[model samples]
Target: MSRRRPTVSTSPSWTVGDLTVHRVDEIPLPPATGAWLLPAATPDVVTGHDWLHPHFADAQGVLRLDSHSFAFVLDGLRVVVDTGIGNGKERANPAWHDLDTDYLGRLTSAGFPPDSVDLVILTHLHADHVGWNTRHENGRWVPTFPRARYVTSRTEREFWAGYAMDEARAQMFRDSVLPVEEAGLLDLVDTPADGATILPGLRLLPTPGHTPGHVAVELTSRGETAVITGDCVHHPVQFAAPAVGACVDIDPVRSEASRRALLGTLADTDTLVLGTHFAPPTAGRVVRHEGAYRLAPVPPVAPVAPAPVAP
Candidate 1:
């Protein structure tokens, strides 16, 4: 008699051939003010991008900026991108301070355990992106993915060496990044100029601006492609006005240029896009509309379950 294996499911997923991408969102935060999250997110400004309603915003026009983590499983390897602001992290922002989201549990329920994750990618070293790299253990931060090799850009660490001040950054380095390094699990690589293919189908797409070494993770399987947009462009509002950057971007000017260039490059292509901080229905494609770019979300893909691994 054959034994049945235990199973895990992460719906809201998209697959191409052998690769599967699942959205494990962390929080559904209230809409941040335009002056802070994005000065251009003002009522009048967001009003211009009328497409934002129903999905990206509420009836009152408040833009939603949720933090999410995507699980990429292929060929028996589990790779998680952009760990969201993790549980019990002490952040500078009131909203992020001491979070308790069921992020890790959600990841576990989705089929990939922290120990089972083979690779963890940090597109940049922001507090939100790197927070879950470690978790609180024995009154000290410890690597969450105990058996995974954490990957990040060498340039990003160099920048943090000089800029690791302020309450937020200092805290992140102390809690999230340092612990991972202490465990000897952090692997630094060059910021790929055009997505140096790290894995068989995964590449690092250099799209800096929000941070000095910000890069998107590009996945290609059987000739189809999808790029995770890190923090290069925060809100879809940037789709219509790429120049309107967030208050948190270290170099807003350079970030805008990077966003515009990326949008232009991906406009009307077959490549799917997954925004690091986009609201639900996060996967989309960039298209030119009325001389401006907009995201046309890939019609939602139903969740599918595969055979479970022997525990």
Candidate 2:
């Protein structure tokens, strides 16, 4: 008898008018810390293991999922949202150290040239979120997207600039962020007190808590809408247990409150939700399931799947 392998499902992509959306996949971390940001009541339930593993044995035994980075295309503009962990980053966790990304190839595979990106919108200045902001060239960190403008929240910029100096996080600023600023491509956006439209169909909505200056990007066009959530909510588990906050969260209480409110606002809307760290097919619709919210992945059908054969 031979063992059968689980079918691998590829991430989905879609176009909103002229904007082509790409979901870039990355490696996942096993749950080694018994307590997850959102833990399940029972160990066997898939919910608990979906986001993070509680033990190394469980992590090795279970099939780990991929994290995602999103790219938004609009009017001859290729806007990348949240650069995943980059190469050569010094962190306490070895897993996140010195990541070498083939994101340029990934972008080309998605049909957009590397230099074609017009804007790079970072939801925050977290290490994982800005890793790809630069690439190593001539033994130095330089802008990855040479021609693109990098936009980030002013509050986030100031916070990290100050926090990075005394904290271990300072290396991220010196390596990834400062270079972008020095290149004159960094744009500091004012944290909108009330939601404000940044582009024709794009709006910036305040959803502070994961970080002091964190904001969610809302896109709308011809009755279609989607919200690109950064770390405002890390995993699907938070939908049911909104109070659960990741250990890295700056303000757990505020993060909890913000999660509940954002979930509620989209609970009844047709907005397509995009999560930065969400598993493959990161783009989805939020639905009420089993008395709580759940993400229903948007199925990719145009690219046909292999037909099954009888044994």
Candidate 3:
């Protein structure tokens, strides 16, 4: 059976008091190459194999380009949640090498200026999550958002700072991470395991296992809340098989536990979930159906057209 490409849509400007949420569109991964690796030691979550067909062909698979970075506008602060794969980096994976992302323009177009971004929250220290941390300058790595203070978990920072020197992961730290540290912009945050309020409406929650110190950001205002799941639950398949863990997960068993607990909490709540790699319309709510969990895609908001003048 052939699979249809997912359609894209944008939600109306959602406001939580003074904070506004906007989704930036990035390139989409080709179908045939998107579904390469299954969770290392876990059962296939997106069963039927139909859902996996598009991303693979003749043993070759592709990860979809639905990769995204989110922007949150709060009280006098433009906070960029995560920076997508950036340009001019030496990546071990050829697919991510020397990539150019129009993230700056996407931010500006969405009403937040790149330079105006006051804080950058890195959910983890992975290559894709921290790619835009810096830019090349004078043959050196420099802070990409000159005015923003880059934030990461203390454990995550320490782990990568040492692990980055290793052959396989060193390039990740060199071109994508260390540059921000060298620029005095990196802020190591020590957040509680359950969750903690970062700002008035923004909170941080530890959902580790994918990485030891990984976290998910939650924004709430006047009862309206949304969570940036980061990489805790990468693909929609996990919604059905919460036990399945990504191959790269540092602790698959622990990660599965975290995913299950987190999903359970939001299962019946009003929280809108924002996943970094969940195709398009990256924002949605978790609903219980057929005695199993499912991801219900949020409908896109219709664009407001200009008013008609006297004809």
Worst 10-residue lDDT window for candidate 3 reads 302-311
lDDT of 1 by residue, 169-242 (tens): 78778899999988899998886576666788888978777888888888889988888889998888789888
- Give Cα-based local distance difference scores for all models: 0.82, 0.68, 0.70
Tens-digit lDDT track for model 2 on 284-306? Answer: 67777656676766644343221
Error of 2 at 237 (Å): 0.7
Error of 2 at 51 (Å): 13
TM per candidate comes to 0.94, 0.82, 0.84
- Ranked candidates, highest TM-score first: 1, 3, 2
lDDT of 3 by residue, 175-206 (tens): 77777887788888887876767678888788
Candidate 3 Cα errors over 4 Å, as ranges? 1-18, 30-34, 40-65, 302-311
lDDT of 2: 0.68
Better of 2 and 3 by TM-score: 3
Worst lDDT 10-window in candidate 2:
302-311
Q: After superposition, how far is residue 68 of candidate 1 from its true place, in Å?
A: 0.9
